[model samples]
Target: MKYIWFLPLSLLMLASCDDHLLGTTESAPCVRQPPLTYENFGLPMIEKNCAGCHSSLHAGIDRSNAPVGVDFDTWDGILLWADRIHVRTYEDLTMPPTGGLTEVELDDFDEWMRCEVFPNAERF
Candidate 1:
């Protein structure tokens, strides 16, 4: 029947109007991205990603440790090696020694290298 064809077409049109099908469900709760200060973002990321081998006590012991004179446990130490860290981690994509950095973490590192410096930030 002619009306039967309309039933299938109407059903198809109704399905397309459904919010779920259109990806229009209720909004996700908003989450503020955490600040990227050293205390908030930098320290935790380095401790999680870089410290296992780059810390003073672990350098000589961990097979993946940074070479001698490189330590990441302290802010001063990180500043000292910041350039090399920038190059190795971002430019060469050859740090962390295990799992790779996520795009989020890499963005944070790029911001830190470009925009951040401590109150007593060292020269050279």
Candidate 2:
């Protein structure tokens, strides 16, 4: 039937893993993560995938593509935006502006943010 095509399209649309679809920001956090620490995982992963657009300065290269006032250059800066990072990365799953990272990297990032637990139960 002509209407049958719409079924697949609707399914595809609903499959988008965005958090907004769930109607709440307080979604389930990730479990089954590796050791959680800035020195161990956060720094290296963020630097490789997020630093280009989020750092203080990167070889004086123009970074108009990224938003201003949100620097991920240091642990403190990353901590400041950790909530947003979790939202954008895990909930919305829409960040890093450009989709430069491979699927493995994205998976790793998502796992780290969600499953990776911090001491004292900190957010980042």
Q: Using TM-score as the measure, which candidate wins?
A: 1
> What TM-score goes with each of the models?
0.63, 0.55
- For model 1, the stretches where C-alpha displacement exceeds 4 angstroms are 1-35, 63-65, 117-122
Candidate 1, residues 1-124, lDDT tens digits: the string is: 7588898899898887722112113322223355457887778888988888888867446837468768888888877787677767766778876658987777667565544532224464
Poorest lDDT segment (10 consecutive residues) of candidate 2: 19-28
lDDT of each: 0.66, 0.63
Q: Residue 10 in model 2: shift from native, Å?
A: 33
* Candidate 2 local lDDT, 31-107, one digit each (tens): 54555466788789888767878888853445556677678888677666766876676557677665566666666
